[model samples]
Each structure stands twice: as C-alpha cells, then as structure tokens.
Target: MDADTADIATIGHRIRHFRTRTGLTLEQVSDGVGLSQSQLSMIENGKREPKLTVLQSIASAIGVDLATLLVAEPPDERTAYELELGRAQASPLYTALGLPVVRPTKGTPTPTLAALVGLHRELARQASKAIATPEEARRANTELREWMRARDNYLPDIEDLAEEHVKASGHVSGALTHREVSVMAKHLGFELVYVNDLPKSTRSITDLENGRIYLPPASIPGGHGLRSMALQALAHRVLGHERPESYAEFLRQRMQINYFAACCLMPRSAAVSFLQEAKKDRDLAVEDFRDAFGVTHETASLRLTNLITVHLGMRMHFLRVGEDGALYKGYENDGLPLPTDVTGAIEGQLVCKKWSARDAFTQTNRTTELYQYTDTPAGTYWCATQTGRGDDGGFTVTIGVPFADAKWFRGRETTARAVSTCPDPTCCRSADASLETEWADRAWPSARLHAHILSPLPTGAFPGVDDAELYSFLAEHSGPLGE
Candidate 1:
C-alpha cells in the first residue's frame, strides 16, 4: 500500500484498538463523537479518512490524543504524545496552571476528552489559570540552581548510575571511547545513524520505540566531544526521565543528563584522585582537567565546578562570556556578585568589561589563562579566565571565587588586579572617559536583538524554538483544553 493509504489504515487500526481497549461499543463511541455507528464503522474499517477535528473527537472519546491515534502502533503512542506534550506544557497558559501534568499510562485510565474539558472549565471558573511572564525562565533557573545547591552540587545517585554503566561496559576510569559508545548503543538495542538535516538547535533526536538515535554530524564536534555527545544521548535513555511538568523540571532533567555525560567522560573517582594529586603542588587549572579528561574547556570547567563544589567543599562560580562581553552562561553556588537582569537572570546580560570574564577577550592569546581581582559592590572576587576563538565565534570560560575563597585556586597570585565598581553609577571603572574619547564618534555598534534569549522563556526544552510553532501547538490542542 502507498504510505498515505497505509497511514490511514494504521490510524484506523489504532482507533479500533483503542475502542476495544477502552471497552466502548461502536454505538457509544459514535454517540460521543457525534457520528453514526455506520460512519464510525467506515472510519475504523479504513473506508474513509477522518478529518482532523473528527480524529480529535475520536481520540478524546477514547481518552487519548489525535496524534496518539495517528501513530503506527498504539504502544508507541504514549512515548510520542509524551514528547509532544512536553513541548505543549511549555506554553505559558499550561505553565501558569501550576498543576503537575501527568502522562497517561497503559494501566492508568485517562478521563474522556469531555471530562478533561470539564476539569479545565472548573479550573477557569474558580480563577483564571493563565499568567505569562518572562520571569518564568529566571524562576526556572533559580529553582534548578537551588536544587543543585541543596545537594551541594553533588549527585551521588547519578554518579552511581554512571559507575554501574561503566562497569557493565567493561571500561574503567577514563573517557569513553567511540568503540565503547557504539557497543553501549548496541547493548541498549539502539542503532546510531548520522544525518545533516536536523534543526540547528537539535544535536540528536531519539526514537525509543524504533531503537534509533539520529545524530547530526555537523553539529557535533569530533573526537572526545563526539563520544561525550553520544554517551549523553545514551544516558538519557539509561536514566529514564519522564516528561517534565515545569520549565524548572526540564532544566533539572537536562542537568541530570549533563552530569551523567560528564561522569561518563570523566569518571568521578578518577577525576577526584587527579584533582587531589594536582592540588597538592599547584592550584587547579581548567585546561589541565580538560586535557586529562579529553573534554573541552567548558566541559572541564563544569566538571571542576561540580567536583569542587560537591566533593571538595569549595564553592565557586563559572562563567562563559562572548567576545562582545555578553554572559553566555553562568552558575554559582558561591556568594559572588555576577551580572544579572532586572529579573535576576545571568545569561545574555552584559558582563562588566573590567571583569576577568570580559577582559580575557582583549588578550591576544586566547588559550592563556587571564586572572584578575575585581572589587564589586558585593565584594572582591578573583577570577581565572581563558578565551578561545572557534569557527562559530570567540568566547571565554572563567572560574571565579570570592576573594576570601581565592586562596584555594592556582591563579590567585596573578598581579592583574582591577577595582570594579559595577552596578553603581559612581563606580571608578566607567567606560565614559576612555572608550568614549577613543571611539565615541568612530564606532557605531548597534544593539543586537537575540531572539534565542526570549525563546527559552516560553519553551521548556530547547531554546530557539520559534514561538509560532508553540502557538500552533496550543491551537491544535485547544479542543483538549475546552477552548
């Protein structure tokens, strides 16, 4: 059969399966769907193609989604709907409800579409359930960070999980090899396939039922980076995260997978031993960790932050800044002053140019570490920064600690000291005198609008997902909400 005909037949089969599974007779389902028994029979027999609305009604009557019925197999419907619902819950209206969204399981019966609509109606009647705010993103970050801090940024459970995985793979204490990743994928019944036509934001897509993972080669770096990315994808399946109920939960899930990936790349015991040995003579350098673990600078810094904060009892802040001095990413369990928006967001805000995180951009050598001491309104902080220019752009990674805590770091002896008066109008390091005098009339740098910054505010999982796509999703699911 042609693919379209086969699809219709499959959808028809699903309708019948769900109808029988739910123990609804043709007459009963037809009555609920506003269709006669004969018409319903025709649809279930694949004689006629149901319209989208008709399909939705059928799905609702059967306590499922239209997309669920459209899947080739009923067993896979749960997974597919979960993936879609994950994106759907990111909508501001759903998020504002603050209800824990649950995915329907085979054993747990879902209410019919009408019942769910009634529930939504009751919720709306009691009080409006919709409140959209940009600060939701900030709140998510704060929640996840607080969770990380509560555990002292150490995840023993995930580390144990990774250790078990590594033991099963017959590999001990080192970066996972490409051959090992492939072996692990096969062991988990997954076939790895590479493609080039994935969305720019997507590095990989997993099809659990099909036991396939689609990796976009161009997006993934080579060597150890590739192995790390592959292991991360496998880690998601191994960890078995449910669909996230909130943006904060989504961030937490991502971080969990990240921690798992880092553990796989640099096993915790070995990393700790190495750090302990290295710290005996010299302060910890991010590059040393990167080289030892065969990971990138960002990965190394994150690993160091996790290791020191959780294992060593040292609280520090990590930063990634672009050449333009925009804060790309940051995490702090330490009480250090970092840049923030009015909403207290760290990402996308401009870092103080005098800060080591930004000043490293001015250094000619991108690889060498640039350490500085800055006295902000909060307190003096010593930071070690290194810049790297890649094909994409130039960016710097910095690890900083409060001045009182700087004695533990290797770069604490650097004479590059700057008294930064940030977030204060009367601060000594204002750009007005030097920068304006040198190029006020010459440089006309326009403020750039980065849509990705706002994209994460609405979407839970992936940044840069167009808002219109999310709007369309809401419109499609409007019937489920009784809109």
Candidate 2:
C-alpha cells in the first residue's frame, strides 16, 4: 500500500484494538458513535476512510487522544505536524500531565493544537463576557486541562517535521549554486526576477502559474543578509518545485524539521548509551556533556534531564534564570518540591550563589549544608546543597542538588520569616539587624510560611551507585568513609 493508505490502515487497527479492549460490540459502538454498524466495520477494516471529525469522536469514545490514533506508524513524507508533536512532547507540560509527549509516528492531525486553539478562543469569549459564575470557571478549567493535554502531545511533532524539510530542500546541494540555478532558469525562458527588498516578515515562497513569486513577510529580510537567505530559499524551491505557503506554515515546518534533527542527533539507542556512561561516571554537568555531544548548552541540559528522568528512572528537575531574573523551568523534583515561581534564594538564585561561593563549596560524597538569603519582597532561604559532578570534565559540569523540607524550616520559627510577612528580606544576616528592626517596626502578624527542607540520607547510600563494592569494603573494613 501507499504511505497514506498504510497510515490509514494502522489507525484503523488502533481504533479496532481500543474498541475490542473496551469490549464493545460493533452495534453498540456504532450506536454510541452515531455511525452505522456496517460503516464502523468498514472503518475498522480500513476499507473506508473516515472524516477527521468522525475519527476524533471514535478516539474520544476509546478514551484516547485523536492524535494517538492518527499516529500509528512514522510517516514517510515527514511533514510539519509530526515535528511539532515531537518538540511539544519534550516540554514539562507533557511530563506534568503524565502523557507520552514524544514518540515516533507518521503524519497525524494535532489533537493537542486543535484543543489549545479552541481553549484560547473559548477563554477570549469568556473574558469578553466576564465569566463570573463558579460553574463557568470550573468548565473553563476542564477545557483548559484538555487543551493542555493535547498541546503537550502534538506541538513537538509539528516542529520536528518542519525543521527536517527546511534542512533537506532549503539549502543548495553540494554541486549546485544559487547563481547557477538562477542562470539555468533564465536560460529555460523563465524570468530571473530577484526581489531583494521583500519585507523582513516574509515566511514562505509560492509559485503562481503565471511564474510570479509570492513570499510571506516573515521569510524576507530587513537587510541584505536576510534578502540573500530568502533569495537562496526561493531559488532552492524553484529548483525543487516545492515551497510552503505562509510564514507560520514555514515555521511550523521548520520546527518539525528541527525536532527530527534533534532525534537523529540524539537517537534513542545512542542517548541510552550516553546515559549509561554518564550514570557510570556520575556526571550531570550539562555544559560538559554538550561539548562531548556537539549540541547546544540548552539542548544538552534538556537531554540530560530526559536521560535521567525517562531512561534511568531517576527524579530530576531543571531550574533556569529567566530574563526577568525570576525563577522558571522547574521539572521532576531535584528535591525542591515548591512551585516554580515561589520567590526565594533557592528558587531563582541557586546558580548565582554557587558561582559566587564556588571556592568555599567542597565536592564530597557526604551531605553538606549551605544557607543563602532571598532579597526583599521575599525572605531568605536557608537550604543545603548536594554537590556532585562527573569526573570526566574535571568538574566542568556541576550539579548542585538542593534539599529543602517544609517541616524543618517551620520548626525554626524564630529564624524563618513567613513569605507573606516579609515577602523579600533585604539581608538574611542576623548581624545586619535590619530584618529584626523591620520585624519590630511593623505589627508582626501570625503569618504562615511555606518551607522546604532536605532530609539527610545515610552515607554511601546513593541509589544509582553500585552496592556490591561498597558492601565488600564495609565487610572488610568494618567502618564507613568517615572512619
């Protein structure tokens, strides 16, 4: 069968599998689906093609996302939708929802994208009407959850496909040059008209039957560099007889292509192997790994998280400083269980603090305690840091794992400031006296503080560490590392 037909067949099989698993009779399923039994049978048999809406309904009935049904096997054509889904799957949103965000699959309709768009529209309408009722809010939240789930699943696939296509056809081949192609087209009686001053917003190139070119605003450049790139892109398309119609479409395709490239760059087997080696070496530094893999720092960091969380079955979280100097990008729980935006030294300022106090901090297998303060509007955070880096890069990639238990901080009521009472304390030092003066100056309310404290683990009890050698050492020496 052709590629598209094979996709349809795989989808049909999945639908049938879900239906069978649910133990619904053909008549019962058809009745629930509002389709004739014969029609349902034909769909299940791949003898008939179902409309997108019908397919969605069938998937919903089976308690699976529509995209899940559509993505039966990886598509041969490698479209934008596939790439977007792949990238979206890598997002923390997908992890939070407990869904398979990233997996190989053929071309499919993005249920997540459709859901997000629909939710956005609904939210806009509700906002315009000033939805005041609790019922409305609850319903909105439900729809939002569904949209989030779909977006978490589909957007990555779209990105992957687009990136792949752009890389494949946008660039001139090894022997061919843009000038040569332009000259060749002219020789074939086609006009070699170059639009150098196209708008910077141009996105895609389209070929009219009359031989006129239509380029989206986003794809065009504000100056010569972009103009050259656009011309080259257009020239490549002219030679290939293919081009995306809009900038958004072009971006969507580009992202898809990028997703595929990332996958190809970090194939599952290779990624797994790298994770095993990293685990063996106990190296968690993203920058060092990026150098080894020839990937960007950001990609390396994300891949490291994925390796530990997905492949190694370890709980990991990523924290990054936002442009606004706020806390963001919290994932998996590297022991800080608090919300991402919660203001504190440990929340957004961990890395900077580590960088500043790098000399004082010692790398040891034993748990070490460290304390730092958060600036006013938010109080100080006294937390312990667990420092470990892989030996490969001479400690270039450092993983400063933090531990904060709410109970421990709450126990130190006299020392700790509530988030509401002093949202941001200017100085955490007891000698500063400003915080004490401020406390005495204002009417201190009986405020509740959210605290996170790290629980100490037994020495030499690392989860991923091999126990056989450690046990053998203990049996022979009758003592631990401290002894």
User: Which runs in model 1 stand beyond 4 Å of their true positions?
Assistant: 1-133, 199-201, 218-221, 390-392, 404-408, 428-446, 456-483
In the range 389-463, model 2's lDDT, one tens digit per residue, is 332211112222322222222122223222222222332213357756777677657733222112121212121
Clashing pairs in 1: none
Candidate 2 to truth, TM: 0.30
lDDT tens digits by residue: candidate 1, 1-483:
334333564677688778888899999999998999999988975679889899989999999976677665434444334334544555566678697875444474343433544555565443331221346666677667677767767888889988777767777655677766777788889877665554454566666656766675734556766677677788888888876655656667788888998887888888999888777765677878888878888888888877887667678889888877788778877776677777667767777777888877677776678888888777788888888776658888888878876776788888888877776744534567776799978987877665556643434344434545444433443342223
lDDT of 2: 0.42
RMSD per model, one decimal: 16.2, 26.8
Question: Estimated TM-score per prediction?
Answer: 0.64, 0.30
In TM-score terms, candidate 1 sits at: 0.64
Which candidate ranks first by lDDT, i.e. highest?
1
